[model samples]
Each structure stands twice: as structure tokens, then as C-alpha cells.
Target: MLSMHYIQKGLLFKKPPPPNNQKDFIDNLLENLKQSISLALFHFYPLSGRLVTRKTQDPPTYSVFVDCSNDNPGARFIYATLDATIYDILSPVDHPPVVESLFDLDRAINHDGHTMPLLSIQVTELVDGVFLGCSMNHCIGDGTSFWNFFNVWSEIFQAREKGRDAVVSHQPFHNRWFLEGCGPLINLPFKHHDEFTSRFEAPKLRERFFHFSAESIAKLKAKANEEANTNEISSFQSISAFLWRSVTRARGLAHDQKVSCKLAINNRPRIKPPLPKEYFGNSVDVVSTETTVGELLENDLGWAAWKVHTLVVNHDDTEVREMYEKWLESPIVYQLGRHFDPFSMVMSSSPRFNMYGNEFGMGKAVAVLSGYANKFNGNVTAYEGYEGGGSMVLAVSLLPDVMGALELDEDFMNVISVANFANMP
Candidate 1:
């Protein structure tokens, strides 16, 4: 588990009409959701538990084990109603709504071990829709675990509405010791971890949502493959490459300034034998590719894309296993925090998360937002757009000046669709 971090996700769904004999739609929805969450918690019991730190070791460690006893403090769940419509968030604007404003402030996950809740849910009913805000302690799980819980909760709600038993296709595997055999026992210094986390404190940056239509993505892929002189490029590689170049240009760095792009790669599939679909925890490695700002921007887009692709391709199962072994031996895992050098961009989240498929018996999610962008600058969280058809939404946070420059880049804006507030403010 990645301690000291919170994965906050907001999902918006269209409000369904009141069922037969139900007077209030929002009240019925809230009741149903609360009941579903309670049912889901029976399976994901750890989320209802608190963190227990073991300080007896040379380096302290923490574990979030299930505690269903009477004294156990359960996960926090809040229900509220918002006066605004979903358009107040999804409509095109100079800046997207602060991700924090979408949820209840008191219910957010606290990083402090003493008061942190493993999971917090706030369902806010909007004028025309409903917003489901989830704040989960990263120490208990990652985005994968968070979404898995959400899907399961939604399934339970849908099943109850249909008067049927929900079938849980995959049950969560909570054995953190499963990876012990992959590497040597290494002590993690709590102080060092705290210091590393402190470096990611909220920066003075603006977050904007950029939509890339299917056609734009196609153009990017085509250009990247054509430039790389190979058809081996993937959509992730292509978009990453394009963003890397554009962001570098936006920073307007000197020719001698070096720039790097760090991508969060899911290590679950890369591991030998592969982790089970239900294996939930922090299983991500930040892999990076570097180049001079001049070279990155001056070269063809495909060139940068190729570099990104190679970085991912080189991290095969063997390399991943070796990394695990090395991580096990190291006293501290220093994640790529805010870089002090020549500029760097870190991208997290993936279009493969199926952000739009979370249907809670109401329709699919019309919009998805992440609150993490408020804490980390140069952070770009990607999601599968509701429009589908290979569309993507990039929730980007960067320094104001750099974002200004990025919006002005003609080459970068060529394929962007202005219909969805993607144009400059």
C-alpha cells in the first residue's frame, strides 16, 4: 500500500425518476446507495478498519487489517444535496471545478495515521444528477481497489433494485505477504516516507480538463506511427509522446534544459504468473523517459512517442521482478516527487480504468474527476470519456504560465475539438 496518499474519485450519474410509489427520488436513491455500501463492506472489511502501526521494528510499518469488532470505527459515509447542476461542472470553462469542491470536506481521507479512515463516501444529489465522491486511503489500496469497490457497490445496488442476488465475479485478495517471496526483506523508514509525501503538497496550479475526440487520437496515432516508421506504437504511447512535447514547449525551457516524463505503469500484469484480478494494493512503478527540451520539441512527434513506448516495452516481467527485489532491499522508496531540475511531468491514471462504465442503476457516469490534482503539480490524470469511441479526458494540472503556453501551441491544438470546452479560456 502507498501510505500518505488519498485516491479521490468523483463520478456523476443522471438522476433517475422516482420508482413506483416512491415520493422522493433523491431520498430513495440515497437509501438504496447506503444499503448497497453496507452490503459491499461485508466483503471489503479492511476498508471499515483502521490503520495499526507496528513501531517495534527497526523501521516502523503499518497495516490495515479487518476489524469488525464492536469497537471498530467504521468507514465514513455522508449524503448531501448540491444546488448546482452537473453542467456547472462538465460544461466548458476556463477552469474545471476544484475537485475538492465536489465532495464533503470533512469526509475526505486524512493522511494522519491516528484519524485516517480507510474509506469515505459522500453522495451529493445535484440539480439534474447525482455525484458519488469516494476518498480512499492509499495505504489500504490503489485506484484499482477503489474502483473495484465502487463497481461492486454499484452491482449490489443494481441487483437489489432488480430483486436478484449480485454475483461478485472477483473477490479481493488482501494478502500483502504474497509479494514477500519476490524480494528481500527491507525496512521502510517512516520518516523518509513522510518527507517524500510532504514534497507533493499542494502547489499553486490550475487544473483544466481537456477532451480528445476519437478522431484526434487517431490523428495522433497516425502521426506517431508514421514518424516512428513503424506501426508498433500504441494510443498510450502516442498521446503520452504528444503531451510530453507540448508540455515541454509550454514550459519554454532553454535548449540545454533537460525534460523528462514519468508514467505510472501498472506492475500487476508485468509480474510473472500475473497477479489475480482481485489482488488489490499499490502495484505501480513510475518509469521515466528523458530528453533535452530542444530535442523533444524540435523532433517529430513520433520520435518522442517512440521513446515513451520503449520505456514501457523495456520494463518486461524480468525487469519488473528485479525492480521488486531492489525495492525490497532499499530502506526507502523515493517516488518521483516534484522535480527541482529542468522540468518534469508525471502522468497517473489510465483510460483502461473504465471510468464511464460505473452505472449505479441510474445511467453511466457522465463525468469523472479526480481530487489528487489539487496536491500534485504537473499531474495529468487520464480517463475514458463518456462519449466512448476511444475518446479521452485529460485532467491536467500545471503551473499557470506553462498551461498558458500549452494552450497557445498551434501544433498541439490542431486536433483538439473546441466543441467541448477544450479551447483556451
Candidate 2:
């Protein structure tokens, strides 16, 4: 409903030629993302609309709009209109575009943790074009959803390029249906909610990037799987076990006591008719596990993997649907994630498949990033394989001490060394 502008003042890495074609790469990218989520697109409309000129009313959604319209197709954009440029990684192609450091949009938004907009974009070439950076509110979806939507949009865009129109109709999660299926749950005077909310204070969140060579990750996973004696384990599952063990150990080390870990439960399929993959919004459930520090540190990783597997498998449709219906009835369950405290920390692991280095005829990108920050003992971890198969990038945030301890553990760092990474590369 509003247009805002930010600037991109970096070298264009071989400036694109004059915009003589109907297909603008930048424009097409924005347009593709727009169509993935119908109403969500309104949150990032191009700069052709008017800038909100009022005193302001609505909580900031931490969303942004970016437009790259320039009058001089070949000229550099104004320095004042862009944010940052891509960071240089030890790879062959350019990484995600990074705006300038001076831009003011990098700060965390004050809105609900889920609704803060995270980026801003600007372009002077099109004169009238602007781009906005907005988010779907963190609680709605994590980077997986963002990347998945981008992947779907890429598919649609490629389809359009081939002169074929791809139409995808997404089915959103219906709270009413969930309610009807499992009766109310939000109002259950379960003492667990009150008890956990008081156990731990809110966590502090920090953002940073980590790189794990593809070689290292593969070898690590293979080694972990071999040690765990499980043929069905994946890199994500193995690494998640590693992190879980490490974090739980750290909590025990700090408090000299036992602790538990919580993993989110996304309940999309639990609903009747299940929501479609393309349903661009929040549709998830959560649950946790209690494990002792001694058990986590001394036991084989297979133990942790089974623990994670058990929680996921046990939370079937009936249990999850009833949980959803209860939440819908009370609307208070929405706040449960924010308030619960039984665990020392909560984590979510996203398996980044082959969607990272998608090429659009420009050499494949060197880096893809997720602006992840861990807050309230809640840390978000994502793993992605890079282009040409080099290292796996891990994006995470947590206390510096915890992060240091994690990397220092021989079991963890040995897998990330350049030599170890090169094995896979």
C-alpha cells in the first residue's frame, strides 16, 4: 500500500547493458516473488506507489519494498538510494547483494518478533523504480519458507520464459477447520505454560554467518551416520544432533544442572486436507524434549537423533490437530512460543537442498544468505550447499561463548577445516 526507497551503490559486477528488453532481470525477480503469495505481494510492491506520508499508524512489519527503475539504463544508481552489496566469500561468483553500510534499515524492528521488516532497496536507473524489503513476520515462517517461495517463483519465472503460464493455487491453513477437528486447546489451564514461561528469561539474539565446506559436511555426516549405525540419517539430522548435544551440554556447563531442548512442530498436514506447500504463510506446531547434560554429552549421536525422531513421529495428525484446534479456540496459543520456558534453549534446523546456487544466466551466485539471529535462548540454524559444490554454509546466532564453545569442540570443528572441506569440494 506504500512505496519506500533505499540505494544500492556497489559495483554492478559488469554493469548490465541498457534496459532495452521487456524482461528486466531485477524486475522479473521482484515480480516472480510477488506472485508466489497473493496478499503477501502487497507487502513488497514496487516504488511506483506513493510513499506513506502520514504521521503513521500500523505496527512495522519489518517488510521492505525495492524498486530499481533508472532513467539512464546504463548509469550508476544514486548513492543515497541503496542499502548494501553482496559480501565477498571464497567462491567464484558474487554472493547475495549487500547494501551499503550507512543505510539505516539494518536495525532489528520494534514490532512483534515475528513482524519486523528486515531490508530496504533502491535503484536510480529506472528513475521511478524502487524496491522494498519486507518480511512475513518470523513466527509465520522461517528462511525455509522464504527460500522455498523463491524456488517456486523461479520455477514460475522459467515457465514464463518458455512462453508457458504456470498457475498455482495455494490452500491456506484454515483455523476454523482445525478448531472443528480437535475442539479448543488454547484455554486449557495447563500449568505447563505458566511454569515454563517463568523458568527462563528472554534470550538475546545475534546474527552471524558460518561456512562449512561441502566436503566437510558430507564427510562429517557420513562419519556421524557410520558411528550412529543408521542408514536413514541425513546431514541435517546428524548436524542437528551435534548441535543439540552441544547446546544442552553448554546449558549444563553454565548452570551445573540438567536441561531440555525444544524443536518446532510445523502442523500443516495435521489440519484436514492439509495446507499446500505453496501456502505462503505461517502453518506450524511446536514441541520439546528433555535430556540431561550428561546423557547428551556421553551418549552416541544415534541417541540424540532417535530422540529428535521420536518427538517428530509421535506428534501425529490427531495430537497435532487437536492441539491446533485448541489454540484456534483460545487464540492464546499463538503466544505460547513466546512464553514457554521448560527448555534452556530452542532450535530449528532447516535442510537447504539444491536450491542455493540457482543460475539466471549470470554465473551462479557465490553465496546465499539468511539474516538469522538467535534470541530468547532460541537459535535458528540453516545449512545450504553452495554452487559448484564447495562448502556448506551454516548461518546461526547465539551467545559468543556458546558459539565459540561449539566451534572449539574437536568433533564439530574438525569437520569444518578447509582441508576437511576440500575433501568434499
Candidate 3:
């Protein structure tokens, strides 16, 4: 009954290397951004359209579609001036609450898409830099697909500025893939849905930014594999395992208390024959692994990493089809979440995304941040480090006390190059 919000993220950029006296740089950039979005909407038409939800009888189901009629309002572009600096937003001790204002939509959830723009863009000009924030309906696509659209938009912007036809790679694939029993206008039972305009409040928590260098990540993987006595530990699995152990230990929960780690997987490559590389829309599915606090902490990092890896390895094409089949019979839709229990942690998004590659003529983004939308205790956002190697950065949100404990835990800090408060003894 949840997930009625946009997926908003911010890309921080410094003012262009040299201020030009010829023309206003900000004005030119804004114009190019708008033009680029307009061209992007040509392929991603759904972003320019409104959502149409109709009630159906017999099954008490809701049928939703993107209304692409001529009169529909297109994407929104907001230009805001902020009196804050990039360091304030990037503060490691406590993530700045002001980051939420960087987005355009004012508490409008995804279902509000019927009246509001499906894609909201806000360019917050900070005192020292600009924060490019985008709010997109989760129904429009998953994180991967959204970045694909972003990459295309930047490509177009570069081509336009260079006075040439855009050789856009990774063109969007709008071919919707519905379940076997579903039609174009998919219907799902929704006797009573959530309030579309409001957003639920998440528990106030402490968040920290953790950086894992390419070498550190490799060490985590190697350590996990060595301890497990199996050379099959993946990088993601190793890090996830480390977090689970480190956090669980920090929480000091009862020995028998169960803890589950939720993670989202892209279903594009898992399906038989695989969907197109640029397949648009939400094709994400979630898988979770759980264990008691005692068993988790009593074991080595490799044990936990292997546990996470097993679930991922097991969720193969057959498992994927079965999950889809069950959903078709009795659909349980949203693959991402907003509400998480106190003992739960979710590792979200992927470091594999082309975060630094979104070059809009200005140099690549300095760092990335998230809106306060899905901030819950133990909610972690993963992004590739700005300096391009195999490095990764995690924005981890946790209970205040748990974060306090995590700050003191030596194991967690060993593999991470703390961005701000890892030295809190």
C-alpha cells in the first residue's frame, strides 16, 4: 500500500572552471538543460504525460496508464537558489536536512502524477555550486532506467552545443512487458489505496557517508571468500555482509532477534533471452536474506557474504519466472520500499550505474546525494566513487544510537575510508 513517491537524487557540481564575461553561464546552462529535456521527452513520452487511474468492478482493481494526450503537462523545471554550501550538504557527521529542498515537487507522491508533472527537475544554485536534482515517479522506471534516460539527455545536450546530430547510445526501449495474464491496461486489486498526496514520515535517524576504495572493496571480497573457503564471493555480497555484521553488532539486539537485509535486483538480464539493454520502466524485483543476530555476529564476514551471495545466485531465471507467475495470479507489485522495521536494513541502488558519466558539457558531477524520501533506519544508498576506479560510496542511515555504536565499531571502519565521522571514539 506504499511507494507513492518520486525517486529524487542530486548531482553536485562546482561552478564552471572559469566564469565567462561574454554571456551568463547559468542562463545558458539552464536553457540547454530545458532543451535537452524536451528532446529527451520525445523518446520518454511518459514523463511528459499524466497518469490516468480508473476504477474497475468485479475485482475491485485499479487500472493505470500514462495519458499522452496533447494537453497534458510535461516535465517540470525548477530553478532555486540556495544559501548553503556543498560541504554543508555533504557533511558526514549528520546529513543536512536542507538537501530535501533541492527537489521541485512539494510532498507530491507518485499517484499525484495525474495532476502534477511526472518528472520534476530542480536546479538549486548553491552559494558555491549547483545541485541538479530530479524527481521522477517510481512508476516511470527504476534507478537504472532513469539513469539511462539521463545519460541520453546529456548526450543530446552535448551534441546540440557541439552543433551536430546527437549520436545517442542507449536509446530508451518503451516496449512494456506485462505478465502473462495481464493486458496493456493492467488491473490490480486495490480496494483501498493509500493517500496519494501525502508522504509518510520516516523515523529520524543518523546518517553517515562511508567510502570504500577499490583496494578496500577487493580486500572485503577476498576476506569474505577466504573465510568462507569458497572463491565465489562477489564484491556486493562481501560489502553487504560486512554491513550486516557491523550493524547487527552495533545494535546489540537480543541474541535470538532476527534481522533481514533487503536488496533490489534488476530483472532485465535475469529474464529468459534477456530484455533489451535500454529496456525502460520498472523491471525491478526484491530479494531478502535473514538470520538471527547471534548467528550473524558469531560467524565471520565470509559466512554472511556467502549467505547474501547464495540468495542472489539462486534467484535465477526459473525463480524469476515463478515470481512473475505468482504475481500475475496475485500481484504484489512494488519492488522497492519506504517503510522498514527497526531491525531491518536495505541496501539500495547500485554502484555500477553511470553516475560520473553524466557529463552535461560541464565536468562530471563531484558527488551524489539522495532526497529524504526513503530515509529510514538502516537504509543505505550505494554509488560509485566520483574518482572513477572500482571505488564505492555508501550513504547509510541508521538509528541515532546504532549510528553512534557504528561509529565506534572498529570492524566497519577498517574497510571504509570515513568521509566525516568515522573517527568518533
TM-score against native, each model: 0.88, 0.60, 0.93
Q: Which should have the higher lDDT, number 1 or number 3?
A: 3
Per residue, candidate 3 scores C-alpha lDDT tens digits across 202-246 of: 677887789888889899899999999999889988998899888
lDDT at 294, model 2: 71
**Model 1 residue 126 lDDT?**
75
Better of 1 and 3 by TM-score: 3
| Residue pairs in clash, model 1 | none
Q: Model 1: how large is the Cα RMSD against the reference?
A: 3.6
Model 3 alpha-carbon drift over 4 Å, by segment: 17-19, 58-61, 195-198, 333-339, 420-425
Q: Which candidate is the best by TM-score?
A: 3
lDDT at 393, model 2: 53
In model 1, the runs with Cα more than 4 Å from the true position are 1-4, 17-23, 57-70, 95-98, 104-110, 177-186, 190-200, 333-342, 372-375, 418-425
Pitting candidate 1 against candidate 2, the one with the higher TM-score is: 1
